[model samples]
Target: MDTYSFLRQLADSWALLALTLFFLGTIVWAFRPGSRDVHNDVADIPFRNETVPVDDADTPDTGAKS
Candidate 1:
């Protein structure tokens, strides 16, 4: 009922374990190894190749200019 009893009860409750777990999880996550260039050396398969021509009309004549 008093302040001292409340403090003592809180110190022994599951709140202490929860707080410890939270802090431990935070430290582990903060110092965990991170990825380096995760997409590096990765290849993508594009459905369409832009380098190929779709129509012959767009090409210029290879004959003489005259």
Candidate 2:
């Protein structure tokens, strides 16, 4: 068997199976029990950012009349 043929067969079979299993595992991990708090924290990150006060020192002065 030539190297190209062997690699092609391996990719067509094992690679496909590996990718499918990885996808399913990710889905299972995402929806598993006892993960609600972590997911909630991630979901609230945008709202948390809004609550933080911005420091004036970080702002640049435009040096123009308002």
Candidate 3:
């Protein structure tokens, strides 16, 4: 109801504490170290390679050229 009471109530509450811990966790996670080696150079890339369907119906005639 009054300034002192309101401020005392705020001081005892968890909102600021929760906010501080959230920021600290964010900072710690950001600084946590691990080398990504050369393999992870691209973050969101999808892997592409040797898997392909070889069904006869899907084949392109090797002798034909367009």
Candidate with best lDDT:
2
- TM value for model 1: 0.37
lDDT per model, in order? 0.72, 0.94, 0.72
What's each prediction's clash count? 0, 0, 0
RMSD of each: 11.1, 5.1, 7.4
In order of lDDT, best first, we have: 2, 3, 1
Q: How high is the lDDT of residue 21 in model 2? A: 100
Q: Candidate 3 local accuracy as lDDT?
A: 0.72
lDDT of 1 by residue, 1-66 (tens): 999989889888877988999999988775667622333323333533548757888889899977
Better lDDT candidate (1, 3): 3
Roughly what TM-score does model 2 have, to 2 decimal places?
0.70
Tell me the tens digit of each residue's lDDT in model 2 across 1-66: 999999999999999999999999999999999999999999998887576666889888989977
Question: Which stretches of model 1 miss by more than 4 angstroms?
Answer: 1-11, 35-66
Error of 3 at 58 (Å): 38
lDDT of 3 at 21: 92
Q: Which candidate leads in TM-score?
A: 2
